[model samples]
Target: MTGDQLLIFLAGIVGGALRVGVPFLFVSLGECLTEKAGRINLGLEGVLVLSAMVAFGGSYLSGSPWIGVLAAAVAGALLATLHGLLCSLPRVNDIATGIALMLLGMGLAFYLGKPLIQPQAAQLPAIPLGFWSDSAAVRAALQINALLPIGLLLAVAMWWAFASTRAGLLVRMAGDSAHATRALGYSVSGIRIAATAGGGLIAGLGGASLTLFYPGSWNEGISSGQGLIAVALVIFARWSPLRCVGAALLFGGAGAIGPALQSVGIGWGYHLFNIVPYVLTLLILVITCRPGVIVPGSPTELSSNK
Candidate 1:
């Protein structure tokens, strides 16, 4: 490749990173919050699928992308809330409940999304910062959706909250030891239920971003386990919201490798390129899972690190 061609390839990578990272950032942040409350919701994959369906259907029906987002959030929260209730019950295993919820979410999404398969909905508008750029390459590179900045800002805000705020202290205490939180006159289950619900809301929003912003359409296959990947990202991030953003971007960039390569007329190994993100995730898991490796900023109560 010539110098200009190499630059173009580099630019494509940057654009791809933003395109891919937005969903990861949102989902990982959600998972980070949920995990901090000492519960794991593996049903996030189902939540994403269901949220995407609801967001698209709601937007298509209401003629507003924002409404769809709200609908998706509500759907996600409902699912998470259900999971929270089930897991809180005596003799109910959280993991089993998560699996059941995942199935339920997928079934519901598929059943309700049947009518929305072909109907076109209003898509979210992208902020065209790239339009101001004189260079075509620069313009293309900057033509990302607005959600990227929003997700990053939220990550920073969440990090600060978890580290500095009184509520953060309480949440950390509750996650680390229910007994400790109870001794402090706090309701541990109640706090966890709230956290899980909030996590669901964010995850649902992430699904909306996928349908209304990135791909700009609602389809059954819109999400290919991105929600599950976000769970992995939370572990990789050590439950830090800020680190989740970085990890999300990395994963997103990895996910974009195939498309980016194809865009530049490099398609010899395109099929293999699709596996890059998953491969990278596995490598990260191996490295991060070392015995006695300190997860310096993780919530003390999280089971993944323990």
Candidate 2:
């Protein structure tokens, strides 16, 4: 391949990492927060699909993508909050409740999103960063997702909070030892529900980014199982919010492999390349979660719960 084509392929991967990985970053961060509180909600797939629909529909109706993002966050929080509440009930299993929530979320989205399939909604604006270069391919590759900085800031905030904040300590304590939390007179369930809802709110933004920024559309297959993949992503990151950022970009880069290959006329294994992210997820899970191996920085209650 020519050097120019190689540069284009590399640029495509970098661009995909930013554009496609934004959703992963948001979702993984959300999941990390929820797990830190010692609660697990696996219904994030439903959250993504439903919020994507709501975001698109809201943008289409209001002529504002920001308004659509707000709607998506609200919808995601509601669904996640429901999961939190249900799991609070006696004898309720978090995993089982999460699965049910997933089904409900998808069902609702499909029913409500029927009309949104054909409508063109306002999309989130992009910030061009490749103006320094004259090449069209480089310019396109460097257009930053408007929401990328927000996700980065959130990661920094979460990491700092976990390290220095009183509330962060309390959440970590609750996850590590319910007894310790109760001894301090805090309601375990209350903290967990709050975390789960907050996490859902963050995950909702991931959904908004998917529809309003990257692919910039609403569809049944838009999420493409990103929600479910996020669970493994959280584990792979070992619960660190900052690490989640790196992991997300890695997944994004992996996902970009197919298009990157095509960009350079190496399209014979396009289908195989598309599965790279999933394959990477499996490898990460196996490596980090091997039998009898204790992953560093794992939440105690979360491990026991699983």
Candidate 3:
């Protein structure tokens, strides 16, 4: 490619990463928090879709994207709280419950969001990061989501909370050992449920980004399994909030590969290129899930289920 073409291609990638990575960043951070609390919430796929519909619907009704964002977060927290409560019951498997919740969330979203698919909603505004450049492509690619900065700040805050806060210590303790937490006179279930709910609230914002930002519409296929993909992302990020940011951008950039090439007039295998993120997810799992390998910073209760 020539210099100008290369610049456009690279710019497309940067824009795609910023736009597409927002959802991944939010969902993965939510999952990271849940895991840190010694719980798993695979049902976030459902939370994501449901919140997207709710956000869009709220934006359409209120004519305010921020209200929609709040509505989405509430919806996600409600569903995630249910997941937490159900999993807390005696002998309930977290994985099984999560999968069921995923299906339920999707079904409910489809049914409730039928009208939403056709309506237009107020969209989240963007931060024009390309005014410094005269190129239209540069300008378009540099329109960063307003929520992107919030997600980044949340990552930094979460990292600090995990490293130097009392609440963070309790969460870490709960995830590492239930017996130990109990010995310390704390309720493991309570701690886990609270963490799961908080994570869900954060993840709801991810859904808001999907419908109220890039693509800026509501539809059944809005997610493209990005919520599920976030599980692998969290694992790849080794459960660190700070690391999740970079990992999210990498996956986001991977997603932008096909679009970037197409923008440069290379449309061949455009659909196939979209699978890059999935392929990357598979590679991460295969490499990390070896016979005797231990993932660094994995919560101990994840394996023990105690």
Give all candidates' CA lDDT scores.
0.82, 0.91, 0.93
Stretches of model 1 off by over 4 angstroms after superposition: 132-141, 290-296, 304-306
* Candidate 2 per-residue lDDT over residues 210-244, each given as its tens digit: 88988998888899989989999999898999999
Clashes of each: 0, 0, 0
- Greater lDDT among 2 and 3 belongs to 3
For candidate 3, write residues 138-184 as lDDT tens digits.
Answer: 78888999999999999999999999999999999999999999999
Q: The CA-based lDDT of model 1 is what?
A: 0.82
Model 1: weakest 10-residue lDDT segment is 297-306
Model 1, 1-306: lDDT tens digits are 766666667767777778878888888888888878888888888888899899899899999988998999999999989988887787877777888998899999999889888888987777665675466875666568766777888899889988899887777787888789999899888888888888888889888888888887877788888888887798788788988878888888887778767766788888898898888777777877678775565666664422
Could you tell me every candidate's TM-score relative to the true structure?
A: 0.93, 0.98, 0.98
Candidate 2: regions farther than 4 A off: none
